[model samples]
Target: SEPFLPFTAQKLVELFGLEAPDWTQAGNGQLLKESSSIGQMGLLFEKIEDEVVEKQLNKLQESKKMNEAANAPAVPMKEIITYDDFAKLDMRVVTVLEAEKMPKSKKLIKLKVDTGLGHRTVLSGVAEHFEPEFLVGKQVTMLINLAPRKMMGIDSEGMILMAEDKDGKLKLLTPHEGTASGSTIS
Candidate 1:
C-alpha cells in the first residue's frame, strides 16, 4: 500500500505520472527517499498560496489607509491674524444683478453684482456647482478690496465668499436678514 499523501501531493503525482511511495517502510525512512518529488511539489504549491494571501492582505491594508485619509478633514485651520489685518479686508454684501457662464470655461461664471457703491464685474469658480440662473438676484458676501485681476481676458473686480459643506458642495454666504447692497460685513 502507498503512503497517505495530501490531496495536492496525490494530484501532482497523478498529473505527472509519478510512482507512489511505499508506506510500509515509512519507519525506515524509505518513504522519504521515494516521495521526495511529491513532497517538493506540495511545498512549492504551499509557498505560492502563502505569497498570494500575503499580497491580498497588503492590498486590503492599503485600501483601508486610503479610506481613513479620505474621511479626515479636508482643510486645516490657518494661523491667527491681527484685528488690523482682518479690518483691512473690505467685505461687503452684494446683490447679483446678472450671471452667465464664462466662454470656453467649465468652472468659471461671470457675474454683474451691485455693490451699492456701483456695479462690478466679478468672475467666480462656481459654475460646476451652481447654475448661472440660480445665482442671479441672490445676495451674497464679497471681498471688494482685492486688487482687480484679469481672468479669461476679463477683469474680475471682487471675490465672492462661499462656504463648503462636508460633502464638498459650495454654498454662497448670505446675510441672515435682508441687507443693503454694499453694506459692510463686520
Candidate 2:
C-alpha cells in the first residue's frame, strides 16, 4: 500500500506563484535527476530577473532624456546665402480668387490664383493650418517659376511661400498692405 502525505508543499508553491515542478524526463520513459533540474531552473529564473531589471533601467533613462530635449532652446540657423543666389528666385504677389479643399485629401487645398499673367491652379498642402474660406481675396507671395507638379490629381502651377514658427505654426507670407496681383517682389 502507498503511504499518503496529508500536507504536501502545494501552499508553498502557490505562495511563489510557481507551478509544481515536473520530475519526469520528457518522452523517454525515465525520471529526470533532481539536483541537475534544480540548477537549470535557478539559471532560467536569474536570466528572467536580469532582463526585467534591464528593461526598467532603459525606460527610466529614455524618460529623462525626453524631458531634457523638451526644455532645450531654439534651433540653430542655417548656412548663409548670398544676395546673387537669392535673386534667382522669381517671387511675385498673387491674389487668391478661389479656394477649396481637395476631395479625398487630408492636407491639400485647391486654390485659383490670379498671377497677373493669368488665373492658374495652385495646390498647397496647408489645409490643416488654414481654412479655405480664409484664403480668398488674400494677396500672398509665391515662387512663380517652379515647374508644375500634379498633386492629388490637381496641377500645382506655383509654390506659395509661408513662414513656419518653432512650434509648427504656419503663416502665409502675404503683402503687408494690398498689392496688385502679379507684381514682382523686390
Candidate 3:
C-alpha cells in the first residue's frame, strides 16, 4: 500500500472504518515531510483566495457599468442632417390657447395653440406627465410644418417639442423669457 500523508490518515479514519497505513513501515518506509505538505496546502489556499477576490472585483465592476448604462441616454444620437434640411423645419414659438386631456387615452392631450399663423389643434402624448390646466397660456416650442395627422378623431396640426430625462420624465421645451405667441424660433 502507498504511504498516506498525515492529514489524509485522519480523514480516512473518520470517513471510513479503515486502519491508517504505517508510513514508517510502508514501501521504501519513507514518510513525506510534514513541512513540505503544509507549505503546499498554504500555497493552494492562497491561490483560491486570490481567485475569489478577483471574481468579487469583476462582479463589482460589472455592477458599476450597469448602473452607468441605466443613467445614460436611452437612444443614440440621430444621423446629422444638412443645414438646408434643418432649415426646412418650421419650428416656432407658440402659446397654448386651450388644453385638455384626450378622451379614451391616458397618454394623449388635445391642445389648441396659436402658431402666430393661426390657432391650430396639436395632439401631444404628455397627459401622463402634465396636467391640462398647467399647459394653458404656456409658451412652448412647436414644429409647425409637419404634415397634419389625425389622432383620436382630431386633426393634429403640429407637434410640441419636449425634453426627456434618463428617468423618462418629460418636460416641455420653452424659451427663457416670454416670447410672442407666433414668434419664429431660428
List candidate 2 stretches off by more than 4 Å. Answer: 1-75
Model 2: weakest 10-residue lDDT segment is 37-46
> Scored by CA lDDT, what does every candidate get?
0.86, 0.80, 0.82
Ten-residue segment with the worst summed lDDT in candidate 1?
36-45
For model 3, which pairs clash? Answer: 116-182
Q: Quickly count the clashes in candidate 2.
A: 0
Best by lDDT: 1
Give candidate 2's root-mean-square deviation (CA, Å): 15.5
lDDT of 1 by residue, 1-186 (tens): 133557765676565554674455355634335444433333424445888899999999998877876787868889999999999999999999999999899999999999999999999999999999999999999999999999989999989999986567899999998889999989
Candidate 1, position 156, lDDT: 99
**lDDT tens digits by residue: candidate 2, 1-186:** 012432333443343344554434225433343342332222212245878899999999888877776776777888999999789888999999999999999998999999999999999989999999999999999989889998877789999999986556789898889989999988
For each candidate, C-alpha RMSD in Å?
10.9, 15.5, 12.7
Q: Pairs clashing in candidate 2? A: none
Model 3 clash number: 1
TM-score of 2: 0.58
